[model samples]
Target: MHPKRKLTTVIAVGVAPLIAVSLPADTADAHGWVTSPASRQDQCFAGTVACGPIKWEPDAVEGPKGLKNCSGGNAQFADLDDDRKGWQVHDVNASETFTWQLTAQHSTSTWQYFVGNQKVAEFDQGGAQPPQFVKHRVNFGSVRGRQKVLAVWNIADTDNAFYACIDVNVRG
Candidate 1:
């Protein structure tokens, strides 16, 4: 074979596998988000609030399992962590049902709800895969007025969890 042709063939053989390996077999799908009560990212996705990238991918606010912020420690979704961002607060009774719409369901370990550092409610799934829609009726006993609720979905098989922040005016 000609010298240049031999070199070109060798390069092609070496590079093809690398390119193929780099390409994923399936595209990354969105996970889940709190729909009812309208979490910050949910508001962004609904166009109720103008936002950054979270407007396009509300279901992707995923991070280390124990994060407290609405953005799940993701800088791309840093807007979610902004308290002054004019997120609409929904009116709710002391006991309310928070609904999650899952685009891609995962095996869930637990669902946790927090107000400040105080854990308001938790549901254990025991590593079971959840349905497309999940709802948790959380009772905010003695906690009233405007509050930011942090909801987390811990994935059973992963080190990450999906985070959402819901602003609510809890009426007694």
Candidate 2:
């Protein structure tokens, strides 16, 4: 085989995986947020087994994510690109462990957040097509903070059980 041809093939083989990594996957947005809930009647329920909404003071506007520009539907959905209040959490705890839930009308889910709620992340789910409902999990990331940690849940979707209500749960 030609030297250049062999080298080209070798390079292609090595770079093929890298290219694939860069490319987004088809199921990428499979289980992600959607506009399923038309209004508050859709779903509602969060926190540690009916204690009330996850109470937490806005530590700070550390982030400006989600659909802050758009309007209608669930405020959480509207908060797609940015937070409605443009609030960012701050002074989160570094060491904490708990398993809470974010249940909705159509589906119910739970999460185990640890290392504080500093940079908490969520995992959303979409169905066969885009514009699916939200199914998020995770405590943001391992980014822990030390100070007056104030954790909270936006309660985007609603659960029929306790629809129109929101709550938060924490354990250590």
lDDT tens readout by residue for model 2, 17-107: 9999999777421121111211111121112122111112111111222211222223433322222232322222333332222222224
TM-score of 1: 0.89
lDDT score of residue 125 within candidate 1:
100
- Worst ten in a row by lDDT for model 1: 21-30
Candidate 1: where are CA atoms >4 Å away?
1-19
- The residue-by-residue lDDT of candidate 1 on 1-172, one tens digit each, is 9999999999999999999999979968899999998999999999998899999899999999999999999999999999998999999999999999999999999999999999999999999999999999999999999999999999999999999999999999
Model 2 residue 63 CA deviation (Å) reads 16
TM-score of each: 0.89, 0.24
* lDDT of the structure predicted as candidate 1: 0.96
